[model samples]
Target: MKTGKRYSEAAKLIEKTKTYDLEEAVALVKKTASAKFDETIEAHFRLGVDGRHADQQVRGAVVLPHGTGKTVKVLVFAKGNKVDEALAAGADYAGGDELVPKIQNEGWLDFDVVVATPDMMGVVGRLGRVLGPKGLMPNPKAGTVTMDVTKAINDIKAGKIEYRLDKSNIIHVPIGKASFTEEQLTDNFQTLIDAVVKAKPAAAKGQYIKSLVVASTMGPGVKLNVTKY
Candidate 1:
């Protein structure tokens, strides 16, 4: 696919606007979204890094300001005390070994995220074939595997979106839909950007945030001027 000049321009702004506060950043982002563009704006985050560097690993979650514009079914892997916590925290599916067979047999990926407690990895482990290919595996490096069942479940229900750098060392995440107001999208966009920036590993060097673009589904990407942040 050909990357447009708009994408490159938006990327420049993303680099420039990195230092702005949430309030100021949102205001500027709104302006970018409202401006006339040569293409439609699909909401996506693009980050570039050198995947060869282990320290370049990027992981974290962010609650989109306007949600993901799609329903997210949350699946939690937990046992013992954490099971109740996960359920009470709003997990759609929270169980043990029994879920393994069901998930594997069904090969389900109806849920957008999978969270597992430290002890529950064993259960989730068996279903890797089912979930791994779908990108739903709960890996600790991605903050999906944790002992805090309640926090994990709640965050997912609250629209927490997680992303990791691909083989190309680029991470892309959806923040909202084209129908969302610019203000709402901007808020969600900034929140995710901040989280990703902070997730940079201390061992990582060079430019952690190579570029950023905010666009819509099947739309042209708008580069964010991020110098202020």
Candidate 2:
């Protein structure tokens, strides 16, 4: 069976961690928080009901954080009004009909994400065959198809981490690696947990945040028992 440590373990680790001062603890926390997933993360996205859906179509955004930790060129399909906006918003490459063939080349996937203004979706939609398989296609449900290019670009750059429920409805995200100082990792974990808890949909009742865990690269996982805000 897979028995895991309880939240008390984290509190114990917190108490046992040695620190000369508050500042030192802060610095150490940042340096020590890191974790490595055993498997490859293909798609990272945030999901929630838009309140418009009875079934919760899972609306959110996905960006190749760390730019996929690899180089990904971007293709934008837009015209007239939204063209310049896409570029200024930090899209790697932005254009209209010209972008389709570029995406056709086997190498087009070298880019990470593709964004299209709602107006241009008609044109960009044609490239679905090329972009869909690569997981590079833009979908409105993911918040990629939008007129607010600036917000999209800024969110991608700001370490907009994602969280989603597993078969157990438990959401997970990496706050930091084990090497990070306890304080630094704690802040990251706290920030993400707060956001997720606050994002709870009306359909979710009883315990919204079921549980939380913090682990480090090559370290064991420790659950966190969060109190309601």
Tell me, by TM-score, which candidate is best: 1
Tens-digit per-residue lDDT, 135-225, candidate 2: 5667765556888766765665544444545444445455444444445444554565456655567774465544444444333333333
Winning candidate number (lDDT): 1
Candidate 1 deviant stretches above 4 angstroms: 1-48, 226-229
Cα TM-score of candidate 1: 0.74
State each model's CA lDDT, in order. Answer: 0.67, 0.51
Each candidate structure's count of clashing pairs: 27, 19
Off by over 4 Å in 2: 1-75, 101-107, 124-142, 166-170, 174-184, 227-229
Model 2: what TM-score?
A: 0.57
Candidate 1 lDDT, tens digit per residue, 63-149? 665676667788888788787888888888787887876777876566778888888888788887778777888987667899887
In candidate 2, where is summed lDDT lowest over 10 consecutive residues?
A: 37-46
